[model samples]
Target: MFTPRTPRIVAARRLQRRRDRDQTGRFLAEGPQAVREALAADAVLELFATPAAIERYPDLAAQAPELSPVTDDALAALAETVQPQGLVAICEQNDVSIGEALAKEPRLVAVVAEIRDPGNAGTVLRTADAAGAGAVIFAGDAVDPYNGKCVRSSAGSLFHVDVVRSPLSVVDLLQDNGLQVLATSGTGEDDVDSLLDGGHLAPRTAWLFGSEAHGLPADLLSSADRRVRVPIYGGAESLNLAAAAAVCLYASARAQR
Candidate 1:
């Protein structure tokens, strides 16, 4: 059994940092679900699991490119959660270029910009995938999708949707690809329901979302073809980032289909 002090386990523990992940062009995926999805995507390079985990998830072990039996302490060292799931996989980063993603001509896309929270970012990615969005772009200074929390929160959706991480003119690019860019905002000219009723949401659309605190940058908001706000029926101030994203993406999904 590999101990925490083992050379391979020590190296794997370093993946907890963004710098290390970036340098190595790989990230860690924890839990059986993540490991399974990573395996399905052919992204896992190696899997480290406790004996119990190997026995519990025999299919995952059989599918892994390489499997290493690890002590519980070793698994803990590589896991971000307090309770390690006994399975972790070192997988390659799967982000593609913005141009490459747009080439698919996705009818619905989510462009997340300057989102700092990994959990929210991941949840949005998962929501986008669930809404049948073809791609998700992490633009500007958004949190890394490969962050441990982000990967975990994605719940395996990270391997389903086309992910793009790039510093580019996102609005212009989407417009060039025949996708109308829509920005989500608290105070906006168009109401989401009105747009849907008017048959405006059925076209190829890319939703631009920013951080909850700062919202979208001024230039991006202005560049978007339409600024849309979700109606709140209750007394709540506003929906959180993930909730708002779900509302917007699902609206587009409903209209497109």
Candidate 2:
């Protein structure tokens, strides 16, 4: 028997459904590594690429023969960019309660807010994964965590951690759980290094990273109990949102250990 061909365009309206990951709380996982990790994690592998791209990663095809494969044009259409790495897998987004994130189980978390750049947001997620953060929260109008660049930049790390998007009020709830909310700012009282180097940090801490241009909004900055900065030891006046997140996350990681 033959299967129906995946579309060359794949319908933009259809792709929008993935933004929420509401059905199963899991979103689309794409590219070779991302798809591979999703399948490995038992995430729903809803789609695959044509044999041309499939041939590039024989191992994935072998592992997930059940994929609904489609052509390169189809793959590119489904993907968010021109450089289609030959794979796309949609899965449940995995919804976890905000309290679950601040339980101090992992002892560290990264909170992102108003990050406009998908690449930066994705990069932050990758850093959170590397730093062993328990979760990453995309608060405010941050870029979609499921953006194609983010899914790619994560390098499969996105699969490893719990990612949630919400408002500052939700962040306040995390604070009530004994999770310190440290907002990043150029005008912060002390550098994040000092906060980390002060030789003391709570078992559960949240790093509220801001946007590239505006940093955190005024209200959010005011809402955070503590304000911290990742000081520039060099000529640079500031750090990229992603890079700053990595530093703070790792700092918390080091502190917890």
Candidate 3:
């Protein structure tokens, strides 16, 4: 059994930080679901799990004979949570550039700008995947898609969709790809449902969701082909990033279908 101080465990632990992840071009996928997804994607470079977890997933363990059995303490140390699921996999980063993802001629896309919350970021990716979006792009100062929390929150959907991280103007990139860029704002002029009813939701569209704290930047909002809002009938202030994104993406997906 591997100890907490094992060289591989040490390296895996270092990946908990963004700087180390970037330097090594690797990230940790915790839990059976994430590990299975990473393995299916052929992205898992190494795996660390407790014997119990290994026995629980004997078929998966058989698929990946490189699984390393570790003590529960060692497994907990590799995981980000207080009580880990006794499984973690070291995976190579799956980052794709804006230009590269755009090359696929995606009909629907989700663009995130400066969203700092890793959970929100992962939720958007999961929503986008469920909506059958062609891709999800993290633009400007957005959080890293490979963040441990982000990966965990995605629930393995990260591997199901194409993801791009770019500092370039997302609006320009989508527009250049012959897609209509729709920005979501709380005080926007157009309502999301209205756009859907009006058939203004383009078949080839990219929905832009901004940081929940600041919303979309003025320049970015203005750059969008159009700005739309989710009609809030309730007294609540507004929808958060994930809620707003799910509504917008589903609307577009229904329209495009």
Between candidates 1 and 3, the lDDT winner: 1
Ranking by lDDT: 1, 3, 2
What's the lDDT of the predicted structure labeled candidate 2?
A: 0.72
TM-score for candidate 2: 0.85
Ranking by TM-score: 1, 3, 2
Ten residues in a row with the worst lDDT in model 1? 165-174
Choose the strongest candidate by TM-score. Answer: 1
Model 2 CA deviation exceeding 4 Å by range: 1-13, 16-26, 53-56
In terms of lDDT, the best-performing candidate is 1
lDDT winner between candidates 1 and 2: 1
Taking every candidate in turn, the Cα RMSD to the unseen true structure, in Å, is: 0.9, 3.1, 1.1
Give per-residue CA lDDT, model 2, range 1-257, as digits (tens). 11234342343215545444443454666667787787777775465667776678887777773666675556665666566577777665653666666564556778778787878888888898888888888887777677667778888877788877777555577677777778889889878777766874636787788887888888778888788888888999888777778778888888887
lDDT of 1 by residue, 136-177 (tens): 999989998999999999999999999999773589999999
Q: In model 2, what are the clashing residue pairs, if there are any? A: 25-92, 25-93, 25-94, 26-91, 26-92, 26-93, 50-70
lDDT of 3 by residue, 156-212 (tens): 988988899888477877898899999999988999999999998856999899888
Q: Give the count of colliding residue pairs in each prediction.
A: 0, 7, 0
lDDT-wise, the better of 2 and 3 is 3
lDDT of 2 at 162: 84
Estimated TM-score for each candidate: 0.98, 0.85, 0.97
* Prediction 1 TM-score vs. true: 0.98
